[model samples]
Target chain A: MKSNSSTVKTRPTPWDALVFAAVAALAVLTALVFYGPKARTNAPLTCVVSVGGEVMDHVPLASFAGEHTYSHNGYTLTVRVSGGQVEVLHSDCPGQDCVHSGPISRAGQSLVCLPAQVVIHLESGTDGPDVIVG
Target chain B: MKFSVKKLALCAVLAALALGLSTLENLFPVSLIVPLPGVKLGLANIVTVFALYELGAPEALAILVTRCLLGGLFSGTATALLFSLLGGLCAMGVMILLKRSRRLSVYGVSVGGAAAHNAGQILAAMITLGNTMVVGYLPFLLAVALITGTLTGFVVSLLLRATAHLHLTNQSDYR
Candidate 1:
């Protein structure tokens, strides 16, 4: 056995560097375009109802701010409405994408972390979409 | 010709280790130098990388799946699970594909798998949101994938080296 520390050199290949650069560029570009000021005011603010998975057509989109638990099939969705934002505070699915999506309030504003098959969307009406969470 | 207790024990230990790594990584989120959304080191994948080389794909899948499921219970929001599952499946598929192709080294396989995982997760996000706008964030995810994948691969290599003598007698060792 020898201490192979005398002549050691580690260098990243050109292709590796290129891949890193490309990926970095893409991440920066995505943040710029999606979070840009222009996307902020695309539509007048409105309420949205996004339901999918198990719960049938019963969730009232108008009274979205209180703590409510909606269960359908095997999935569970707990919504917490604060101020104007409505968000999934808890769910029983395998992926926790929904909880990490933060809060969504503005009309046309939506956030979904899909591993749980949960969907969050803004509906225009103060009443109903007759939505089914299949 | 029979499965040995030693083999079962090794698998059990590896599975536990993998789960532990997943939990540990989830403790703190690493914000990268680049301000890209959903980019991180994925330190738990280090165990997955090691499992791929040492225990093979099926074992790795078991460990990864157990970690993903139980992990979701701890801190992950629902959306996280969807993203992780999509990413893990894509990564596993890519690993299998590369495994079939004799040209790729373990490191290469790891990188490919990591990249696939990120791509898959991002694609899932895009589909769920019904917006293609998320695609723009891909480059950042890729960057995270490449760097973390390479590091994880390197760690796996070191682990393999340290455990070189623990060779079990099996026809399908694949090494």
Candidate 2:
């Protein structure tokens, strides 16, 4: 408390650097643990749409073979749940991050619209990325 | 509850500023820049940090809660409200603790808040989505938080220095 807290001293101290490094390490470790290599399977993929943990839609990935639209909280989203992939094609949500997530073909992948409380995830038995290095 | 007129007016203005910033941040073309899901600059955090340092903890908390509620109404989503409230509270709690500790600078406090906000959002998602798979993305989100938090801390530092003369909060009042 020698000086004031409103000064121009913004240089991150060594401790600050250590905190950043710790976060980075934690990130890497979590990635490795969560996305580690899993046994891939050729089983069929099922697309599930859940809102507030309630299943709104569940269909075989290729059964739809068309654009399916879902709306919540005054926002609309168009998703492609066919052609061997599940992806959000368009959304009126402000962030549009879900739309930008591209398509998820393998199991354990998800497209989440936080604003709408919607989660569209691909599920399969014993199916995940065979290789997820780094 | 019983406050000076100046405090009341300042809280209203700060809350409004935070709300406006939240709306503007949502409009940011973050997809083009980060191409990551559920990530953004969190521009509203700037106002929260400013208020924490200049106005005091209660004022900052009030402004944050007000902003979240108003932002939820503006977005017309209850789910978003939950996430905002959770994330805002988590970030605020961490920043307040760090600020009180006086062990780290604004950079550390801001960075810690950003990371906490993201983690809180992910936790909210897990509860709403009823699955833990979303945790896989936590690493990526935290990585981005570091950079965004650094930028926010830089801006807060600048604002603190530039406006130090005003002395909105007496030195002994908050410190």
Candidate 3:
């Protein structure tokens, strides 16, 4: 402690509301983009599971069956893949967000487990570009 | 940006405090309670804000950088450090600009910083995961940051008030 006296004359201002409102609006717009509909396509969907930033599996949703257990960072996830849908039936991760996410069937939807650094998402099974320039 | 003995000592303390706060926050089952991925309340920001206001930009930046490095090591992975460092820098940048503008209260600055922090983390996640599905989690993270940031701001103000008598610095270099 300096014990010299005086300082911290600054106080919180009313602009706090403005900043909160702006961030709130931005969050809503982004959430819409996240869960919003995507362009319809006939390409088969693939369930992609990535761990530690490595692609562990890219199984075609319809063809895949049964549960696969992945262990990472001392946590394990039992992922159930069937009926063209992917779900985390159980996980040892503390958050259990992947399990709570239920299941994802649509392309671009993901179930993330941060503790395990696992990502499960749906994408076009083809892995081909829609358009190629030049 | 010469570091006086007092300033250096204070910066060290603040950096340690920030690291401690963040580690303490991790002890809570916040992720389990919130069910949101990569959502941290960023409690360490209290120390950052304190340094930014009481000390100057340079000192605050030093503390932040040190905390990130140490935090990364403590987290047991490079990726955790990457996200934490990026988020911390972005949050500190926003808070610095907002504080300089003097147009917003401490709460506004904290909220803005929190928002920036969330954005930065999501950006890191997107790049590392090689996909955009994580982007959908943005709004949820920011929404939560709004509430948490406001409270962080309020706490900073209280901290400033309580420490007003400590005389950390006789000169104000905040701006």
User: Scoring model 3 with DockQ, what do you get?
Assistant: 0.38
lDDT of 2 by residue, B33-135 (tens): 7778678898899999888877778889999999999999999999999998998899999889877755577888889889889888988897898766677
Docking class of 1: incorrect
- Assess each prediction's global lDDT (C-alpha) against the native: 0.63, 0.80, 0.81
Residue-level lDDT tens digits of model 1 in B1-175:
2435765676677767866776666565566445565776777777777666666677778777877776776665877777877888888888777655544455666677788889888888977887554565566677678778888777776766666566632424332
TM-scores of all candidate predictions against the true structure:
0.55, 0.71, 0.74
Q: Sort by DockQ, best first: what order?
A: 3, 2, 1
Q: For residue B62, what is the lDDT in candidate 1?
A: 77
TM-scores for chain A over all candidates: 0.48, 0.62, 0.63
Off by over 4 Å in 1: A1-134, B1-4, B32-34, B168-175
Candidate 2 per-residue lDDT, tens place, A36-102, comes to 4442334677788987678988877768678888888887888886668888899888898899889
lDDT of 3 by residue, A1-134 (tens): 24322333346556667888899999977765545443333368888889999999987888778999999999999999887778999999999888988987767778999999999988876664322212
DockQ of each: 0.12, 0.28, 0.38
